[model samples]
Target: MTAISVQNMNVWFGTGALRADAVLDVSFDVNEGEIFGLVGESGSGKSTILRAMVGLVPTWSGTMQIAGETLGKKRSQAFFGNVQMVFQDPYASLHPRHTVDRVLSEVMRLHGIADVDERIVQLLDDVGLGAGFRFRYPHQLSGGQRQRVAIARALAPKPTILLLDEPTSALDVSVQAEILNLLADLQQSQGLTYIMVSHDLGVVGHLCKRIAVMKDGEFVEVLSVEAMRRLEASHAYTKHLLASSIQSVS
Candidate 1:
């Protein structure tokens, strides 16, 4: 089953005189329970695709479908309930003033879920934060802990699809591994689909079965993770990226 389908997607910014294309002629499908990766350097429109899907970037033209239903220009509340995003920066994404408990509780309230207290604790536990971090502020936790809270918050609404934008880029090397493992576990346990955007080919190679390489607001190539691992990319741009990734790890 296709969890997400996007065709001929274009995202533009600015008006007539100052207009710019952020993403152009992009298309792809992510299967249910699959981890689909978008990889490229900054400003390559990897994150723009994600922002467009969630309606954050409204200046877009294309057809987008989530779980076989056509997505309209204006998303309904139910649409948001099925899809959620976990941002790159945990500290920036979370509300500094709101405690962890309040952060998770608010989502449950918005989703009309009863027994907020129990659900909040369960959400925290699900993300590996446990109940101990409930009353803590974002300042009190480490980067990894804060990200776990962010993950918990995104899952509070019981979303089936998660859009992860550089989810571990801000964390420590050791912490990055933990967060990645947590994401993998969550997807397996919850049967969730993920659309992850990152510049790190190593990270994507580990998490995704398939990946799309984006360049200058368009996809340079779409290939399996095995092709990426074996450095067998056909496109010149993709081969360049693979070479760079190999050099970075060496």
Candidate 2:
């Protein structure tokens, strides 16, 4: 089943004389329970695609069909109920004053989910935080712990689709793998669909079978991770990126 279908999508900022395209003529399809990756350099418009899907960037044109429903300028409440985003900065995503419990509880309440108390505990556990971290404020948690809490909040609504925008980029190198493993586990246990955006080719390659490479607000190539690792790319930019990734780790 196709979970997301996008075609001829164009995202821009401003209008008329000042109009600038951030994403242009992009298209793709993601299967249900698949983990799709979008990778590119900064300013390549990778994050804008996720933002458009979640309705944060509303100035987009063209087609966006998610979970079989066509999207318009405004998203329905039901749309949000099925999709949630985990931002790149875990520290900034959570409220400084809110405890983990409140963060999760509020999301559930807004989604009209019942048994909030029970669900909070389960969500914490699902994200590998357990119940002890539930009452700690965002300031008190470590970066990895904070991200887990953020993931818990997103999961509170039982969303089937998760938009991950460099979810592990802001964390310590040692902590990155732990969070990645946790996400993999959750996806397996719950059958979740993921759309992850990252500049790190290796990160995306590890988590996603296929990836779209972008340059200057357009998809230059779409290929499997196997092709990415083998440095086999039809586009020159993708070849450069693959070589850079190889050199970075060398």
Candidate 3:
């Protein structure tokens, strides 16, 4: 089952003289419960692709479907509940004044969900946070802990599809590994479908079953991990990126 499908998607910021293309003719399908990686450098439109799918980039002209229902700007109430996003910056994503308890509860209240106390506690434990931390403010936690809170908030609604944009980019090496392992474990347990936008090849290699490499607002290559590992010097840009990412680990 395809959880999301995109066809001929293009996003333009301006019209006429100032027209600029952010994404061009992007197309792909995300299988149910599978992690699909969109890997590319900054300004390559990977993030734009995600925004389009979730109906945030309304200027786009294309076809996008989530869970068999097509999407558009100002999504219906049902669309909002089915899809959720975990942004790159945990610091910016969470509210400063709100306690973690208030943060998670707001969503449940908005959706008119009853009996949320037990659900919130279970969510905290699932994200590796104890109930003790639930009352703390965003400033009270470390960077990694803050990210776990962000993940918990995203999962609070029990969304079927998650749009993860460089979810581990701001974390330390050890913290990154822990978050990655947690995401893998969560996906396996819940059968979640993930569309991850990242520049880290190693991260993609570890989590995604298939990857699409974007360049100049287009997908220049889509290949399996085995094919990427066998890439030659002929693919100058791909080779450079792969080598740089490998060196980053070493």
Candidate 4:
């Protein structure tokens, strides 16, 4: 089953002479309960594709489907319930003034979910944070803890599909592994599907079974993890990326 399907999607910014395409004729399908990765350098239109899917970038053309339902330029409340996004920066994504309890509770309130208190505790526990962290502010928590809170908040709405944009780039290497492991566990336990965007090939390689390499607003190649490990990329750009990733690790 296809969890996400995008077809001929084009996203443009500015107007008239100032206009430029951010994503061009991009299309892909992510299977249910699978982790699909989009990898590229800065300004490669990877994040733009995610933003467009959630209707953050409004000037887009073509069709997008979530769980076989066509997505519109403006997503409905029901759409948000099924799909949620976790940003690169946890500190910026979360509300500084709201305590962890309030943060999780607010999402449940919006979705009309009952048993808010129990759900909040469960969400915190699910993300590896105990109930003691509930009443604390963002400033009181470390980067990894804050990110765990962010993950808990994203899960609060019981979303089936998660869009992760550089989810661990801001964390330390050890913390990144923890978060990635947590994500993998969550996906397995909840049967969730993920579309993760990152520039770090190592991180993508760890989490994704298949990856799409993007460059200059288009997909250069879509390859399986096995092919990537074998250095069997067909595109020059993909080979370059793989070389860079190898160099970075070595």
TM-score for each of the candidates: 0.98, 0.98, 0.95, 0.98
Per-residue lDDT of model 1, residues 168-195, tens digit only: 9999999999999999999999999999
Off by over 4 Å in 1: none
> Which regions of candidate 4 are displaced past 4 Å?
none
Per-residue lDDT, model 3, residue 39, is 90
> Per-residue error at 178 for model 3, in Å?
0.9
Give me the candidate number with maximum lDDT.
Answer: 4
- Report the CA-based lDDT of candidate 4 relative to the real structure: 0.94
lDDT of 1 at 229: 79
Instruction: Give the lDDT of residue 3 in candidate 3.
Output: 95
Pick by lDDT: 3 or 4, better one: 4
Residue-wise C-alpha lDDT for candidate 2, range 4-107, written one tens digit per residue: 99999999999899999999999999999999999999999999999999999989989989987899977788889899999999989999988888898998
In model 4, how large is the Cα lDDT of residue 70?
95
Better of 3 and 4 by TM-score: 4
